[model samples]
Target: MAASSWPVKIYNSSSITTDSLKVPLHAFIRAYDAPTPSIVVRADTQVFLDSLAFQDDGKVLGFDLDHDGYDRLRNTEVRYLIDVYMPTRSLASLRAMGSGDVVVTPSALQNTSVVLTTAGSGTVFVSAPSIELANLNISVSGSGGFQWDVPATKVTSGVDLSVSGSGTLALSTTTLDAGSLKMAVAGSGKAYVGASSLVNVSSSVATSVAGSGQVNLYAAGTCRDHKVSISGSGDAFVSAMNCRDTSAVIAGSGSAYIQSTTTLATSVAGSGRIYVAGTVPGGLPGSYTPMASPPVTTYNAVPVPAYEPHKTKFGSHVSTGTSWTRDNATLIGVLVAVLIVLLVAFGVYRCRKSGRACFRSKTERPVGYARKTSTENQAPSMA
Candidate 1:
């Protein structure tokens, strides 16, 4: 079943044929053609190891799970660096033998097994440009899906090659995934390479985003969970900092543009027409993205509004039937003195029912006039 892309090199050292192989411990080491034995990893099962003097293609470096050869490799970290005591998961070359490889999932490790021992000197002790983890020589690119690449001889982790995926493509010590690849999770998944993402500096790439989720993109065969998309045209240069999304969906349609450090909850649906230059903080709700078709045609402007102070916190108070508090100016002066005493009692009851006598608020007085005149006349007479 031949179908290996990108700089090809299945387990170099010249393709392997069994030279210095000792896979000791209880040694099962199946997969010569598959029946399930040589530490079976199933699917495209392979078994070959005879790198003509370990051309570095054939690697076997410093393994120290506290020595004793990792107690004969059962499973540690993640395995299959390459069968027997396993450890040599090949992406074809460019490797670093972490010598603790294992990959025998017959069913969540059912009947779980591990028994391998080795006797060297048959030729296999090569290391070039390695930086710990046993041996180092690198080159790897693999994918079951989500766009994949990178493979062209130069691996060594017990002996070049290793990649098992349901999702999440990895291998630390400086990783550079090349093109547009995507991944989901569960075996630690993630891969996407739109925007012409490339990295090739001899091959030692890493400067953060070293691990932990998110590679969701929607297009050219979609991808999901905790998204990472780029559509239509692509122009990206995202740096990276504090991101913890269990499943935060960030969508972009066609003209894709995303900055970073974003947060929002509940209802947020955009149907186009959202153009912001920057700085619009304080609260943020007021036509933030509600362009329901209007005289829309704005460019280079400033209009930010959305602030409700509530005049000193929680609607100040001013009832008056007995008492509330905050006296907003004595409740407008007792509602303007009860509207001027109800307009002087309705104008003295409409001047005593229209008979008219509401002069000084109801004028009607002449009863003592006569008595005053009589008293004046009498006094003159007596004198």
Candidate 2:
């Protein structure tokens, strides 16, 4: 279909590919289950489609913005709202080849896998309620930023997130129960993974920050077998309730703070600092460097008043004045001793009052008794 023939308006056109797309500045790209898979690019202003192709068993869609036999729309200040529709039983894959901001929400996708790459100041937002994918791979090598609002059940399989060329990436999720999660930041970029509950990495998690980049990860629950590497003045901070058998390597003046792990192994070099909490099996190895401790303050103590003892009308001795300390163990021992003495004295008094010995000799019997043999008292037996 031509760009003008669509149900939307059109502006000036430039000669590029034979197809033209007219879409508004702000539009909605929706995907729904249909009898046949089709793509409709509706724009407020007319735009040309340089190239569009479907490959990979009709499961992939690739589009390029071209004008005047040249790909100028990608580098120009033009934005379009893209909507994709797929079949009920088909899984679609999207590849964005332009340098623009791409925002993906859960409502905009069903069963899909995404691969996004841009070399401009682009921004990609993945804010979804629930996202289930085979894999997720995102690479941004510009001064752009990528923000991912992970849902409660996020990332079924593996996730590869990378940001270079001073780009920034942020991920927020309640739980990341994936097979594996790998994140890397280089060229002065920054990356953050914030988990509200626990970042349950079923397989492994590896993070690297180099070239003055920074990476911070926080998990409220246990993280199993995580590895972190920082070099070239980069800083990495990781904190979890308990981390089992974790490792960290810091080189070239980089720093790492791993807090509250059941077991940790650290290797540091070049004036790097590795701060670990909990237990380190054989202590830190290699050029082990400890973090600096905070300063302590001193305070003056107050004097306590002396204690005074008095006897009440009920004949119970108690402390009459303030400032008294009671030794619990000593008090308990004394009470037990007094209880034993009282019990013995009461027994003796009872024996004296009753005029009977409290204990009898071993040879004495309780009452009068006489021993009789069988022959002494014999009864007449029938012959």
Candidate 3:
């Protein structure tokens, strides 16, 4: 059969599926969103190739080459470049399985799900300047790269992005207002969620970096929770503006740096380092001990207050009371006393619960003794 004789197939359906495609060298394929679902295959010149075939079974349309003759053209030279076009509707699910570079542009896809996978070294680019979709999934196993540039307004549900076998994945967006956003890297691959990639999420985000892979996430907005695990020699860097809860587990020599509005629940089993910052309202775990540091204040240079003169009703000049200074000495004293009492109580509670002394130095006075002496002194004053 001649390659030029390959028929163009069109379907009046809501979805499209294609078998595994193995495009010969110098051939290109492009798929985009359209008003209807259609497929077109065009070649520069006629060439005899009995492996090509196209089928449309009412609901699903597929195009592929026969395995027997496809293998025979593995080393054959191609003088013509064949172009394949598969345009689908926004309500359709376009599932493409191949090892070729796929480019998806803005407003080109509003499908329920857009799945693209490649087992070879073929890059994938999905850019949505405007348009929202339910799901977007892309995976690459070879040394190829995947880049997704979309805004939060363009993704209504979630995104699952993954790269393996030394492939790289990059997701860049202004905000991601989805239920969840997941990115994973394995087998020496690298994944990056840029500074403003996910500014806001409704549910949670989970990331995994294993097998010498590296994952970097920065400037994430408010979310319900976040979980990240790093194994092997992989490293993960996460920084968020705000979140309800966060956790990280490092089991290998990898390191993780996380900064969020709340403290993180972390576990470090190997030589890895976990750096966490922000208010820890929930406090650290029982097995975790934090080093205390004194608070530092910064003073700015400013002029002292000056009061302007004002005339009273009696025709006498008087200075206007424009500013007043508050006396917070008593408030400070009370706050300090309360803080000390709370600390002593917490120490005693821990000692009693664990059945062990919670003091670090033997020369220091016990919390109970200090509380007793303070109580006795205050009791005398009260009397």
Question: Residue by residue across 32-150, what tens digits does model 3's lDDT show?
Answer: 65433444443322231344565555444455554543444455533232344445333233333333344444343435666655444445555556456688676756565566666
Q: What are the clashing pairs of model 3?
A: 199-221
* CA lDDT, candidate 3, residue 262: 58
Q: Quick one: ranking by lDDT, best first?
A: 3, 2, 1
Candidate 2: tens digits of C-alpha lDDT, residues 1-383: 44345443222212122111211112223335454444545432354333222222233333433223133333343223344434443433333322334444345444445554434444555666666776767665556556667656556777787766566666667776677778887656666666777777667778777667666666454556778887656766554424566788765556665643455677754445666544454564543334333111111111111111111111122221111232233234434543543464456556657877544322422221232111111111110
Tell me the deviation in Å of residue 6 in model 3. Answer: 13
Q: Name the best candidate (by TM-score).
A: 3
Kindly report which residue stretches of model 2 are placed more than 4 angstroms away from their true locations once superposed.
1-29, 35-37, 44-59, 67-81, 88-92, 105-118, 219-221, 278-383
Worst 10 residues of 2 by lDDT: 303-312
> Model 3, residue 26: what's the lDDT?
21
The runs of at least 3 residues in candidate 1 whose Cα sits more than 4 Å from the true structure, single-residue gaps closed, are 1-169, 175-183, 186-227, 230-383
lDDT of each: 0.22, 0.48, 0.50
Each model's TM-score? Answer: 0.19, 0.58, 0.60
Taking every candidate in turn, the Cα RMSD to the unseen true structure, in Å, is 37.3, 35.6, 26.9
